[model samples]
Target: MNRSHELQLLSLEMQNELFRILDFWSKKAIDSEFGGFVGRINAAGEVVPKASKGAVLNTRLLWTFSATYRKTSNELYRTMADRAYDYLLDYFWDKEDGGLFWECDYQGKPINTRKQAYGQGFGVYAFSEYFLATGNKESLAYARELFALLEEKYRDPEFEGYIEALSADWQLMEDMRLSPKDANSPKSMNTHLHILEPYTNLYRAWPNEKLKERILVLIKLFQKRIIDPKTGHFNLFFDRNWTVQSEIVSYGHDIEGAWLLHEAALETDETEVIQSVRQSALKLVEVTSNEGTDTDGSVWYEKEGDQIDKDRHWWVQAEAMVGLMDAWEITNDDWYFQGLQKAWEYIRANLLDTQNGEWFWSVDDQGNPNAKEDKVGFWKCPYHNSRALIELISRINKLKI
Candidate 1:
């Protein structure tokens, strides 16, 4: 097929996959007895009704449905987004505290009331998208409120980047870990990356001068602190003074950041920053494509020194496809295009669960699905894969193939 034909085919495929994802989540993940969506659904397709609901899952659901509604004008998607938005404000929003609580019970009561910066970022992201979808002034107001809250509560004046976690009342917490698997450090690449992502989205919706200034600060944080100049890989964890705390390389974050950084720069509309980040984005993509990808085009989970995690996670592969296609757009490189194709092939063969709906959590090195992980959970949501499909469809259509 010609290059134009190839892109057209890819766009159609991505659109189909995007709708399939929306259909799966809308039908399977909704909560009937309890408001909003269920917290956990096992690999056996059973909902764990009593599972503690996470801010991330709910916020992502809000963003996905809102964005889908915006794209398709589907009233069902709008209804779902409205349900998520109401649940978020009614249950997750700490009205007195001003930021979202980390987790809530199935009955929509706060369980873990810690204010995670990552969760706050997603809150802004979802709310802004909801506003764009429905032109709801309240949603936009809440989004702007969250943005201000993050700036006031999470931003460390002594340090450049935001803190990881705080108490429900916005007090500093000793254990600032996002999860048990993460390092208990004051700073993390994950939190800062998410913050940058939402800020960019918020800027698209609001375009305030202060938001623009903060977005530039986040871009600089990536340039100076998070990304290693010597190696393109990101330093996973950090101390308060911007000290690198861990030698771990999270492949998912790297590829995700590769494009996110570029998008942030693009949002700024500054020629100099855009030109600089364009180069940095390609380098990050190059490193990930070289060291992180398996032979079958699946991205490895992470690497600490020589100890490489061979698990091919669903999110990692999802991000890899977008990031690689992003690189292809920047450089018009056929290699990156091939990488994108390979990633799609691997995802269709391995990551996607044919019998069950939606993508699996991950597959082992040998391409065996990890059945132990929850299919829908706090960390596992429709955001990455769904966004990837939407992103690929949009990006491919823009390519002058």
Candidate 2:
């Protein structure tokens, strides 16, 4: 078979595999025992009852299934999305506190009540899309509320960026850690990326004037502060005044941001923004090509100086495929298309757990999938991989039509 035909067949097979896993997890992962989804499921498909549930996982579940339902017109997918949406509103959202909680207990109580802007941004992201799917004004209003909260409390009027986290009552907190590895920075690429994400979704539903400007500014923030002009990799952490604060370079985030920044620009519809974003994205594609990719078609997690953690993360590969595909679409380059196909082949060959329903979170340098990462957990859900498959299928289908 020729190369084009080979890629078409491979993408078709990947789409089928992705839908199968989504169907399996949609049925198996729901928390009929408590509510929403069960807190954790290991590599063996064993549920961990004692694990505390996370807002990020549940919100992402709602968004993925909701988007899938819209894409496929599948009632089963819609049902799953509704379940997650109800659970998020009922359990995770802090009605009095004005944003979503960080974590929840097993029985659906608010355990980690701090308002992480990233989590709230995702809440808005999911709910706004849910509004589009179901026309639920309640969802739209809630999404807008979260948007306002982020702007009012987290956004820096003078400094031109969002703060990382706030206490339950909206006070700035001393401990601003998103994950243990992340530094306690007032601003972070992680938070800003997600904030941009939800704002894009909200604009789709509402199209408010202020929202549009904020989104425009966010793209500029990336160009001005986050993205390294020389290398195209985003600086992970930043001080309150937008000074670079971290040395670690996250390959996954670089690739993920490449596509997201493009989307932000495209969705905004400003010619200058799109032009600028297109330029930055091209540079990012080159940087990841040089520094991130391995000879095995996998991308590493990150590097701290000479210390390279060579583990191929599940989400990183998923994002890399989409980003490479985005690059191909933007530049019409054969190399980017080749890179997308190669990444998908690597994912199918190694990252996918055929016995289990989902992917292994990490894989070794030799392409052995890491067995320790849970199949379902606070950090792992159907979002990244499912979105990757949906994106690939849609883009190819659009191309065909």
Candidate 3:
């Protein structure tokens, strides 16, 4: 097939997959009994009632549906977005404190009340998308409020980058890690990348000098602190003074942040920043394609020293497709386009659950889906793969070919 035909065919598949994803969430993921979406659906496609709801999952649900609604004006998507928005306000919002509570019980009672910067960033991301889709002044106000909360509580003035986690009342915490797997560092590339993502969306909804300035600061930080120039990988964890804490390389974040940082700069229209970031973004994509992507075009989970965890994560595949297409867009390189094609084929053949509605959490090196993980849970939300489809379809439509 010619390049234009190739693009057309893939775009059709992506559109189908995107709606399949949304339909799965709409039909199977909703929680009629407990108010918001169900907190946990196991690998067997069974919902676990009474599971604690997470702010990240809820907020991502809000973003996925709102963004789709914005594009298609689908009332079903609008209903899903409204449900997520109402649930967040009724359950997740920290009415007394400034930011969102991390988790809530199945019945909508706050459980893990500590405020996480990552979750807060998703709040900003989701609320901003909600506002942009519906023009709801209250959603925009909430997004702005979350932005101010992140600035006031998380942003470190002396050391620069934002902190990882704070107490329920927004005080410093001893165990500040987002999860047990993460190092207990005061700062993280993941947190900063997420914050940059939402801030970019918020700037689209409502451009303010302070928000744009923060976005610029974050773009620079990634270019300097997060990205290793020698290797084109992100330094995962960092201390309060911006010292690197870990050498672990996550291929997912490397590719995800590559396009995200570029997107941030594009939103700002700062020529110097965008020009600088373009080079880094292409380099990051090239490096990830070289070092981290498998021969089968599946992106690995992480690399520590000489040991590479060979598990093909679902999120990594999603981001790799976008990053590869992004590089192709910039350079018109057939290498990246081929990489995108191979990676999407890999996902279709390996990661997708033919029996279930949504994609599997991961497939091992031997190409077997790990059946132990949750299908939909705190970590497994609709954002990554859905966003990839959304981005790819939009970009493909704009292609001259």
Candidate 4:
């Protein structure tokens, strides 16, 4: 055996980045006024006191810190996770509706009470991880409640999919876009992909039969609808009847879903499902690498047909490292390992803020960092990069070095 010298060196970088990412969030994101976490931090490293908080950011904070604590048993991580949990329940939870509000004012009052299925999925994901770390019954109950609520309210019977969002009380909403850039469609690969991620995490703590079934269904759904067979990329937006509504190819989601789908299948007892997922997962990796990544090793943001978005976004690079590493583990291919090395190098050279603690949101075509984007905000939570580092570190430790 070569003793995994290559992986050992890479693991050192990942461990360092993991701590930096967590430390930055802990020190800067805590809100003294609002109870949960701060709503946003501008690009200049200044916190926006009056910025509204989001369920997505808070729940992702809960998940990231809880996951870090579970693996390391660090008291500081536990305290941070506790803070996220306390704030999440205190402000974000809709007691009457049994789901989380989409957004809240700086004073912790609900401003947008719509129940986005995506938000509820993170609720299950975060609460389940917290329960795993602490064995807290209340957290477990919340996780299960969110899981059930998602099934009851979001699951589409006719399409065997999920609707995007509903009113606070679960009534159908006319506008179903997850974000302004997103198409107003009932079903989306992004939503379904994220829902599958949380459900997979929740199954780790509960492992109920229904949860397993849903996980299996979600995996098959990816194969049948979410992933376009010809391109091996995700179909971004979709309608109620499982029709793909947009032609956008989200490289981050494609690569992330590659490994995630495989992870979901592994949690189940179905042999056929695991085998099917294996092939689909590998195809996703291959296609994304071929079309979605640059020669310098960073993944692109998105592409449609032959038109590509050349800018490198923070989350895209974070996911690319993990996705390539996961592909290496699946096939034991040095090619994927090489890709991972390139991604890490690119991130270090471009996205990482050497003077600051966290990473830059993105670098443009000329390799200049995008300064207008929020350093920490509703969409810029610590989940992607932190999770990527954690995943890489954990996987490296498992190798027979």
TM-score of each: 0.98, 0.97, 0.99, 0.98
lDDT per residue, candidate 4, 1-401, as tens digits? 25388889889988988898888898888887657688999888899879999999999999999999999999999999999999888888988877899999999899999989999999999999999998888999999999999999899987797999999999998999899999999989988988999999899899899999899888888899888978788898887998888988988888999888988988886789888898898899898899888899988899877899988999989988888888888888899989999999999899988766699999988899988999999899999999999999999999888
lDDT of each: 0.91, 0.88, 0.93, 0.90
Off by over 4 Å in 1: none
- Model 2 agreement with the true structure over 56-102: per-residue lDDT tens digits: 99989988988888888889888998999999989987778678889
* lDDT per residue as tens, model 1, 148-259: 9999988989988899999998889999999999999999999999999999999989999999999999998998888999989999898999999898898888999999
What is the clash count for each candidate, in the order shown? 0, 0, 0, 0
Ranking according to TM-score, highest score first: 3, 1, 4, 2
- RMSD vs true structure, all candidates: 0.9, 1.3, 0.8, 1.2
Clashing residue pairs in candidate 3 (N, C-alpha, C atoms within 3 angstroms) = none
Candidate 3 local Cα displacement, residue 334, angstroms = 1.0
Per-residue lDDT of model 3, residues 1-401, tens digit only = 78889999999999999999899999999999889899999999999979999999999999999999998899999999999999999999988886799999999999999999999999999999999999999999999999999999899999898999999998889998899899999999999999999999999999999999999999888988889877888999998888888989999999998899888999999999888999999988888889998898899999999999989999999999999998888888899999999999999999878798799999999998989999999999999999999999999998887
TM-score of candidate 2 relative to the true fold? 0.97
Give the per-residue Cα lDDT of candidate 3 at 361. Answer: 95
Model 4 misplacement above 4 A: 1-3
After superposition, the stretches of candidate 3 with alpha carbons farther than 4 Å from their true spots are none
Badly placed stretches (over 4 Å) of model 2 are 2-7
Q: Is candidate 1 or candidate 4 better by lDDT?
A: 1
